[model samples]
Target chain A: MLRIEGLTAEVDGKPILKGIDLEVPAGEVHAIMGPNGSGKSTLSYVLAGREGYEVTGGSATLNGVDLLGMEPEERAAAGVFLAFQYPVELPGVGNANFLRTALNAIRRGKGESELDAMQFLKLARARLKELQMSEDMLKRGVNVGFSGGEKKRNEVLQMALLRPSLAILDETDSGLDIDALKIVADGVNALRAPDFSALVITHYQRLLDYIVPDKVHVLMQGRIVQTGGPELAKQLEASGYASVQAAA
Target chain B: MNTVVHSGAEGFLHRFEGLRARLPGQRLAWVQALREAAAEQFRVAGFPTRRVEAWKYTDLRPVSDAAFDEALTILGDGDTLPAPRGERRAVFVDGRFREELSQIEGASFAIGSLAEELPRLEGRLGALARPAEESLVALNTMLFEDGLLVTVPTGVAGGVLELCSLASRSERPSAFHPRHLIRLESGASLTIVEEASGPEDTRYLHNPVFEIELAEGAVLTHARIQREGVKGFQLGTVYARIEAGATYDNFTLNAGARLVRNEIHAVLAGPKSACHMNGAQLLRAGQHADTTTVLDHAAPDCASRQTYKTVLQGKSRGVFQGKIHVHQVAQRTDGYQMNQALLLSPDAEIDSKPQLEIYADDVKCSHGATVGALDADQLFYLRARGIPEAKARSILVEAFLQEAIEGVTDETARAALESAVAGWWEKEAA
Candidate 1:
């Protein structure tokens, strides 16, 4: 449902993602592994339509729609979600209120009726349970004093509520403990369906153990150099990205 | 003297003389003396101009240029003012106490008018409302028409005391000067909610002053919400004295008027006293708002915390000047202050100065000021979450002012403040 053809991007006038060609069809999970500064995060940002990231060359499409031409909110309404590497701390915006607003925005975009407070709360509570987050977290400000793991789990909770068609997890496992990693993976795994897809970006293969991917791609020097199956993840985990870099 | 262009000064002095002649029938000798002295001081200092250091950002030209006539008594025609959601209620109209319009329900304390009770507590009033070099205070004291006098007796507690000041104009260029004196005896606890409102579209000025005295071990929570008429102008001052082991918490919200200045001066007079002052200003269009405060630490181990937030849009202007003074004897004093402003339009302006003057060596004092527009990155983040740009901006703006509102100790008051903010957001969005 997602396609990128020779996508070249630049941030701050520096070329970051150069000629990245990839495709993720419906009902499949893809893992993009890369070293630091290999354009992993940049790719996620560009897909989610973050500002200041100039699209220099090529094109990206989602479900046969031009994604680059739309605003961030429009892209989100078109079912594009990015789990930020570092979630922002919104001091006074309640988590439940923010989530309800986002959920209704997306729903209205798709010609659906908006949920009221009660209905929103019921749906949010169920999603919170799935993500192993307490109900009190909904009362506090969005991610104000949440732990690293809780923040990641909150991101997963939002994804579950929004139910995006293509989810991009940008370094979601950077600060999670083993248990948190498992819970986050469980949340993602539960959302896996025939029509849903995700791009899991990480440096290690540990998160892959919980949410196994159908395709694994090695990204080095702003380009995807190699593509393989789940076994390639184990190979890279055992030998590190040195051999992958050498091969590239 | 030149009798040509000095007509305004002559009329002002004539009003002062008329007020002095009417004072004997209103109060005792000491009170009359105090008024006379204050009138002399006002004559000497006159009104502050833009050249004054403290009044630089605020120009009183429009107010001074207008011929201000002495407020005449126009009591409500038996229609009492709306009672705030509290037990005790006091109402003042045109700077005169309207006994028939006020209600003091429940047996918590003694509440009366300053004209009646000032004689008994003259010494305390003199000590608390000491005449300052400030011209505005002098003017308020000299021509003060009526005032509220409240005393929460020792060990008294429960329920909030509401003070409502209503100013309506039957004639053009009229002004009201309402003064208040509140004393919380030792071991007393109380909450005072002051509300200032006026007739819609009425062009008037409401100059109100409040002096609060807290004895040892006293605790008082005071919240002032100013939602006067858009054509009204307000210049209100609050002076509070905190004694040993006492605590004073104040919150001010200014959401109305063409020009409003709410000044607060809190004095930590004894050891182990604590004071917290927090507020927010929401200005739009041609509105101008200012929240200036000065915290004085006179004894050791005193603590003071202040936080002020301003959100300016269109051609609005906001000013926040917070100063903390720690004397030599105020060792181990802890003072923290922060002022932040969000400018939403190119014509919007905010002058924020957070200052600290410390003479004690062993003190922890910090001040910070930040002025900026909304974070583009955060705005994009919210927009990318499927939230509309307008709604996303409102959420961030609400978050920016949340810290100040949440500092309010009363839940109902906090909710009221949040609703006020939501109303402002709706207007801004439109």
Candidate 2:
């Protein structure tokens, strides 16, 4: 389970996430829907331990392990994964080489024997096939010259390969089309198990139609104002975030 | 040569006066005149300082301050040399050829020590170089004891050849100036991998000068790797002249030495000739490396391309100066140059200058330079993917150098460069 209490964060001396209290139990997928300045992305970045995001007062944990006190790679080893809205492009870095290195690093952290190149290639090719991505991606530089849809699909492919217990999708469906959205949703749904949980943060209700969340929370002004079942996402779609803003 | 006296360069001039009769090719009148003219130039100019335009970024105070004695005899037979990178090897110890340590049994082309081949190298030795113009070249021309001399016959494809310069461990500070002469006849081709290395704690100088001549329809690929000791200094220069339909491809990697300067002067003197120069400089704390090149387009329809990358860590410094000159009669010339630097620490420094002087109206020349630290977003992305911080930094550094290494076409040379880069990362991370 992933839990957060009184999460207050600032960027460059300005508050962005204030008093954010949320929790997602195991075997559940929750969605956080908000407007442009609702600080949705900031929440995910803070949870991932990115630099420059100063946490004034916050307590976040996964399975009773403190998340705020560890490095980004340590948080990843503790089963925290953040799918970036803008995937960084790494020129001259081959995708196959990068994925293998990441996987081997995590495995080493878990005291697991590392996989050789051929074995890692087999696993990566299988994951690419499931995501419907071309094997040519393994040959080129990571995210270099990739289209918008291709970048999104690459993120999903990474999430599948890493297989983190707690995944955070921050505005992943922004530039994706319906078909691409379905592929991403299937990738997430395929990892649904008793030990898996996810926090799907998005803006529109169209993505929720494909991957129905167990719970939906209305976030406004860096705070969660209301919480309900999946029907809250549909209700917000009919009545925009303005209604939630007024109620808060 | 007369016992001319100069202030800053008197140390070398005094040595040249004492070693004139014992130097190689002393029996030839042309060689004597060449040495005398070079000595005269060195006597007048001395070692270059910061005031000079070409030596603005690099300072040679460390070289001039210390008195460097000459290595009189060869190292003992117990000394080990670096492994050869090609089939044929020509080894040089303390700038003198070591025939027993070399392995050039069945070489198709002509390869021998310049000291032994001085009779055959009458006018070709000093034909390409301008010792009267450059101080370092003049210093090398006056004091060079021995070097490699290679010549390929017409239409023959001379295979891979390794020229290794190893500086022996000495108790006192010493210096060696090796002058190499390489020529390829028309329609001939050859690949040369030049490796220079020394003991980890030796205080010495390995100043080499190369004079290359490429005839019509000929090609030469030269790759140089400099890994001098921590207390050593290296100041090397190369002069190449490309004729019609010839190509001069050169790549250099600077990863060692307390201070180093590698200079190249390439002149495209014939129509349709090309010159491709690429290099990477990797420096750590207390290290300084410089790569300077001057490309001259003297004929019409010629092309030149240059790309250089420098990665600095700790308190190290890096410098790159590239100039492309197009003559008035050189119409339809194409020239491009780019230099990029990545500073790994706040204390690291880089000085990059890209210059272009084009007199032709139909020429196309472009130059660019970029200096930056590692990208934060890229670093975070890699860390978030579970790669350790040190590993991620190494990965990014390797990626930045890969672009420059790709321009090297020869497989053997490229492999040698890749291994050197890997070794650098290992030492850095440790």
Candidate 3:
């Protein structure tokens, strides 16, 4: 459901994501494994339409619609969700309010009726329950003073609430513990459907163990050098990115 | 200290000479003398200039050139006091109390116009609010039309008092000075909401002076929301003297008027009293709102706090000046002041001054101020959640002001203020 052909991007006049090609079909979970400065996060940010990341020469599409042409909110409305590695701390914006606004915004964009406060609270409570999150976290400021695990969990919770068609989890397992990883993986696994797809960007292979990917892509120097089955992650863990870099 | 007289005040001096004959309480000898003395004070001091520290951020030259005379027309036909049903209300049109619209007949405490109760209010009229160094206060004292008077009986808990001020229908811009008096007897209590508003697109001046005195063990909660006409000018001052075991809590929301200033002077006169001054200023597009307060801890064991927040956008300006003074005998006093502003535009400006003068040996006093823009990461995060850029901005601005708005203790008052802020944001966004 997601396609990137020759996805070249840059930040601060310096090339980050040089020509890259990748695709994730419907109902499949794809894991992108790379070391630091490999442009994995850059690709995720470009997909999410964040500022300061200029897509120089390539085209990325979700559901065959141009992603880079839309603003951040428009991209969100078009079902592009990004689970940030470090969720921003909003001092006065409550998590529950933020979730409701986002849900209603997307729903409105799709010409659907917005949910009332009662309905929103009920829906948010149920989602939090499924994600093993407490209601108190939703009452407080979004990601303010939250632990690393809580921030990641909140990101996953947001993904669960939005239920995007193409979800991009950028380094979701970076600061997570074993339990948090399992919870986050469960949150993603529950959203699996014939129309749902995910691109999981991770440094380690541990996250893929819980949410097994149908395909594995090795990204080195702004290019996806290799694509193989899920067992490719096992081999990469056994060895290291040094071999992959030399091969690329 | 040398005083710098402004030409703006000199013009006002000429305007007051013709308006003095029609001032209220003309029959009362003390009241007339009080007005004359205040006029003399205005002549001597003139308007405070930029050379003076207090009037540095604000200038009265623009207001001086406006041709706003006395409000000649009262509440006309089809006019209504916007007070909610069942709430105690004392409505005023052009600084004159509207007895027909006012619903203070059956309130537990006494409420009437200053003109009707001048005999009873003579002793306390100019007592609490003696306009000495301030030219605006002096001008208000000299040219006041008619104001409300509320007196809570001793040992009785009073209900919510709604003191509302609405501008009248006038072709040319009009000006009104209202002198309100509030007295709470020993062991008395009261909560008051003062709202100042006018017809949209009208140019008027609402200069009101409030004198509040809380006796021993009394409690007073005052919330003033100033939503004058968008093109109007509002300059108001409040003087409160809190007694032993008394508590005076005041909260103001400055959201309207092209040029607005709300000044407050609170004195803790008895031991163990407390006073809190908290407010929020929301301005957009050439609006200028200022809030200045002075807290005096004159007795031992008194506590005072001042917290203010301002949000400015589109070339707007905001000013906050607060001072806390602890007397030598005021040992164990606790005084704190904080001012913060959020600038939503590059052209927006905020000036804050916080001062503390402590003579007591054992006292805790601290002050701080901050001026900054909205966090970029916060805006991006909100926008990423599908909220539009404008919606995200208003949410953060409201949140920034909520820190000070939350200081209002009463629930009904808090809700009223919150809804008012929401309404202002809606209009601003639109």
Candidate 4:
């Protein structure tokens, strides 16, 4: 579960998220739809504890733990994952080594035994099989020289590996094709559980068709103006955000 | 009153004057004359100052004012030596070869202490070294007591040889100049893994000069792993002459020493000859490391490549100067050089200079330099994966150096270099 009350945030002295309140209870998926510069990405970044996005007057929490007071790594250890829109390219870091180190780091934070190299390789191979990815992806550098769809798939691969309780997909569907979008949606849908929740920030409603959301929130001008069921996404697909802006 | 400006070479000149009669190869007239000439040159030049273009970035105040002991105190035989990196090894304690500790007895090629093989090394010794032009070489030529001498005959494979130089712990700061000579005959191949280290708290000076010669169709791989004491000073110089169809591959890792410099000059003397100089330096907290390289394309169709990376943390400083020169007759010469540095802390500093002087218009030569801090986005990406900030930084640092480390072709040598870098990271994390 996640909660944000009066989440007023700014970037470089300019306000982005004015006053907002939103919550996603356990076992629910929420889709936040908005036009450009509507604070959709800003809300995601602020919740993920990224630098340069100052939460001026608001509080965000996960599992009743204050997320605003923790470092990014601490937040991650507290079961939060942010799938970047544009995945960073680590030129010399191998994908397997990066994943193993991250897994061990989170394990250590959770007071669990770390996995050995052999064990990690076995687990990673199985996950790659489920995702229908090549073993060669493990040998190559993380996100280096990968195509846009492959990058999205890599993000999903990371999400699958970390298995965070609360996942924030910040426009992960932007550069993905139809196939990759379906694979990504499947990857998310596969993790559906009583304790798993996700906040999907998207511009279009195409991705929602693959992984239907329990609730739809139309965020406009740093505020959530409307909330509805899964049918709201189909309505937005027919009528663009311009009508929603006028209504808002 | 007229005051004399200290050239910083006065103390070494004085030491040379006193030890000239007792130095190695003193009985040979040519060797004596060579030492005297080098001493005279060193006396005139003293130590290179910041005013000199070649020494512009590195200041020698720490080395000059150290006031090292006048004579080397040869430690006792019971001194503990670090483990050998390979089967055939040559150990040197404070610039003097420890034959008892060495294991090169059954080597097919000629391998022994330079002082013991002086009569056979008459014409070959100092052939590739330019003591007259380089002050550090002059210092080494004048005062070198004992060093490794390896010669592989024509068409022979010398395999891997380990050269370990361990500094003795002395209360008084001491200085040693070691002169290592390695020659590979035509069609011969050899690889040398050289390591220099000392106690973490010992304050000493390790000034070594290496002369390498590769004949036609020969291949020579040299990897220098320097992990000197944190309070020590290391200034190493290497001169290699690669002949036609030969290759000189050299990689150096500067992971320790309060002040250190690894300088290399490689000349491609024949068509199709190749040289690759790659290195990485890790400096932290009051440490200073410099890597300077000069690649000379003297013959047509020769190729040279160089890549140097430096990572600075705390208040450390790093410097890299690389130059590639192509002669008029060296048509179709291919030369490439890249130098990069990553500053871990705001106080860390890096100075990089890359130069190319080409006389042949038909040659392909390029050089580039980059200095930057860790990318914020990259750091956040790592930290966001649950890795602590310190661990994330070290991972990035290691990754940055992995590219240059891959250039080392020798497996054993590359492993040594990799472990040295890993050790540095472990110490930093601790």
Give the range where candidate 2 chain B is weakest over 10 consecutive residues by summed lDDT.
B72-81
lDDT (10s digit) by residue, model 2, range A62-166: 988999999999998888889999999999899999999998888887788999999999999999999999999999899999988898889999999889999
Candidates in order, TM-scores: namely 0.90, 0.98, 0.95, 0.97
| Model 2: fraction of native contacts | 0.80
Candidate No. with top DockQ = 2
Ten contiguous residues minimizing lDDT sum, candidate 4 chain B: B70-79
lDDT of 1 at B178: 73
Top lDDT: which candidate number?
2
Better of 2 and 4 by lDDT: 2
lDDT ranking, high to low = 2, 4, 3, 1
TM-score of predicted model 2? 0.98
lDDT of 1 by residue, A81-140 (tens): 999889887888898889999999999998899999999999999988878789998998
Can you list each candidate's DockQ?
A: 0.70, 0.88, 0.68, 0.81
Model 4 is docked with a DockQ of: 0.81
What are the chain B TM-scores of all models? Answer: 0.93, 0.97, 0.94, 0.96
Error of 1 at B169 (Å): 4.9
- For model 2, the superposed segments whose C-alpha errors exceed 4 Å read B1-5, B73-80
Position B107, candidate 3: lDDT: 85
Q: Which of the two, 2 or 4, has more DockQ?
A: 2
**Tens digits of lDDT, candidate 2, B24-47:** 989989889989999899998888
Cα lDDT for residue B238, candidate 1? 88
* Model 1 residue B86 distance off true place after TM-score fit, in angstroms: 2.0
Rank candidates by TM-score, best first.
Answer: 2, 4, 3, 1
- Please write out the lDDT profile of model 4 over residues B109-209, one tens digit for every residue: 99989888887788888988898888888888999888889999999998889999988877788889888899999999988988898877678889899
